[model samples]
Target: MLSRLRRFTLCSLALVPFAGPALAGDTSAWSAREGTAARLVAGGAQEGSHDGSLIGGVEIRLPEGLKTYWRYPGDSGVPPHFDWSGSRNVEAVEVLWPAPVRFDDGGSFSIGYKRDVVLPLRITPKDRSQPVDLKLNLDFAVCGKICQPANAALDLALPPGGIGAPSAALTQALASVPRPAELGARSEPGIAAAELHHASDGATIRIATHVGNAATADLFVEGPDEDWALPLPARETGADGRTIFVLPVDGIPKGADVTTARLRFTLVDGDRAIEVDTPLSAR
Candidate 1:
């Protein structure tokens, strides 16, 4: 057993030297508010590893009823982006997404987590023998009818040592990133678009027709900002609950094209969220 352990240690050490630096010189910590559209708090650091890899994750806290978007925010929202270009002794970093919840706004939709979310991270060391340091600049979006864009920088240090279990915070985050189910179920990518037309009276919009069906779904739009008013859209049901809807352009533009609005919806049968790239057309 002793001989085997030693051999394993040597092999691990060899892989360590080849590892790249993701966090080595700078170490700062950063966080975001819990209620904003991008209600995410993230931090990064270097930690002990067997083969030059560090275990880390971005911790996010979501307020009740609020949500943060995934890599693809669906129709109207923007996804968060992480940058570590300033760190030294770091070659690369990768993000591991936990399963997300389906977010619906009346008849529109998007995919994201509500309560809280923790994003997993993969860190590689630049030097196997030296303690590694990491710095991260994180950017992401949050929404509740209105959307918000946020950015922050964090620094962390990892001592040269053996790997250990994740922190309590990490454990909680893992719980939030739910596991996916039923791979055999055929479904669209779950992304849709919403185009809002701001007219004299009220806003009018349209959602992608590719969603499950009209009767079983509801529509919602994140107004023009990340924290604004988004009235629930009226649903028009058809045979088998599948129908196309055309809302009035009361307060939205009459002839606005696709770029002006964003739409999201949720299907009732399953908790699946569908997003639409809806564009406005003349009545």
Candidate 2:
């Protein structure tokens, strides 16, 4: 009878499933580097999303006095890169950048976020019925006295039903992204005009902006392509009571037509910012 009881106990134990590590939560474990650390946070399916899109974010934490670059790191800095090939059931992932503050790097001015930042991600699932597994390999730079490259590998899984609710951090990050605007927008903190002027030395782009405070307003310009390294715009007072920003056209790519090149302008004032894309034309 004792042998029979022992055999029955063994059978019952064999039938029971083995326990493993717990499933990941909405936020992934932090992947730490030298002066920075990063993680992935799932914001679940967006409410009332038309295309079944989901919201997520890459949160980067930096020590005091350290900073990370924007999509186009001004003057001299390396931008962050993301690789999501290892993910499953993901059709596309769009990274959105928040408005960054301008800071001095050595003697040159650079644009980036200090302390911490959450880059909002808009994700589309290949199979909405199945869970989406996200695998990211993020490579970014952190600068203080000097710049250094940092890498983090992060993963998170989102079920079809979602993580119960949206993430507030992601919501704020999304709101911080520059709103799209047209050239010559009349709104405050907007681009009023942009024109190319020719001088004996070379060509320069002059832009006029409307903002509450001229001292706190700034403008950043990007060429049609990444190869066109445009300089930061310098602020000046316009004769017509608008704030003017001027930049010399010194970094045009060879063989590229300056008159037809489409330029992107990011105008920032205080806590408000706007992005405008317009063609370059001589005044």
Candidate 3:
């Protein structure tokens, strides 16, 4: 068995040299590690398209039964951190996360991806007249029995005017990202309401959603900022054909105003999911 110390030591050696620069293809060469590998993929835009944003992706591949953490890792694990400071002809980059599945890590539940995932990127260029060069330094963790840290440096370039057809891989990845929805929207697979209930013991949040199967559904909550490490909500019995989840109002930072807090809720039911952002409110 690989001990924790040995796993980390091997992981450190894996990062000694960065992967070579991307060649002619829209996808970069895979940067392979012990149990994981990563590559950057470019989704070219249609000719003469002026959508103002270009699509790209960071693809991470994990061995079967191994996993990686999401933006919020739940009970334990490190979220992926990205650095693009080395890029040229780029103004901003936004990484969009696909819906993550729940994992039973020992007795605790963690949220992340299994097998492989392509985190789609929406990039804005400083000058549309010139090609955009993208450099990515990705830091993430992979876990099975023991979690291990991994890093990859990747590069990709997009032509001026965002020409070329979007890659099929990136198209599928972009489709997996949760679509934004409003609270109380009467849409399938949507959050109906989020109410806060206070008692002598403590406060808990109740969220109601409209999904096909309540038993297989799951909900994840995120506070306004990274400082808030909110606990994963538990599924409970619901009424009126709605799925219910309850989250204890613990993990709020000291002196933080609960009323002013904007919570982000990601509701996942099998292959369907939706993202809802709204202010906290009392029942």
Candidate 4:
């Protein structure tokens, strides 16, 4: 039997320090942690350029068993939000999501990380050679069987030069971040349409998965941003075990058209990872 809502409880690890003081800055910037197995360790920082802008990321690690949500928290959570108001030189920060996996939490399925992961950010540096101090306020929700929301404030300082060299652990952790699956292995595009119902309260998206074998296919949604902290939506199968899923849009942008939103998701059943991308439109 497919699982239901009441069974899931999300556990999160925001900015928990597990090791020595990171070379760039100090931990005094962020708040406290709640999860013992899932703590944030300064994965390190980097300086580079994307397009023509100064770019880099504040790397963080979420180890095994403990999962973190994606920008589009499939069904019930909010994505991680970071406020970088602490640095004067910092112009902006954009998160880049590596791919994500579909997991059955409680009885509801969603997209996120199950083990070690890294989140890269594009930052405008004050001085490439001089040190830059950053203070960030982050928030997210995690689920296992009981859901709990976590909040933190973190401070990191980057020294002159660059983030230096990445440790072997960082390299391995990066490898675990989800990436886009091969297109050829995906199902046909017309198999589903996520209809959004916008109202004064919020948005509600109904995902209709059209497949020959509903029991063999599962669905997940990715967000337009990098912090995957959104909640896993509550889902229900119709009489045929294949039908529409009603998802709450509490954190989603109100009246925003998902029609143009660039999204990528996977349909995993057994060992097959069927990737799909939806163009902006309403059914």
Which of the numbered candidates is closest to the native, going by highest lDDT?
A: 3
Candidate number with the higher TM-score (3 or 4): 3
Candidate order by TM-score, highest to lowest?
A: 3, 2, 4, 1
lDDT ranking, high to low? 3, 2, 4, 1
lDDT of 4 by residue, 165-205 (tens): 54455454444344444333324322355566777887676
Each model's TM-score?
0.48, 0.88, 0.90, 0.54
Global lDDT for candidate 2?
0.79
Model 1 residue runs over 4 Å out of place are 1-50, 161-164, 172-283
* TM-score, candidate number 1: 0.48
Query: Clash number for model 2?
Result: 0
Residues 167-269 of candidate 3: C-alpha lDDT, one tens digit per residue: 7877877787888999998777888898898999998899988887788988999988776777888888776757789988877777776667899999887
Find the 10 residues in a row with the least total lDDT in model 1.
9-18
lDDT of 2 by residue, 135-200 (tens): 888877777776566777788888874576657877888888899998878899888788999989
Selected candidate, larger TM-score, 1 vs 3: 3
lDDT of 1 at 184: 18
Better of 2 and 3 by lDDT: 3
Query: Ten residues in a row with the worst lDDT in model 3?
Result: 1-10
Higher lDDT: candidate 1 or 3? 3
Which scores better on lDDT, 1 or 2?
2
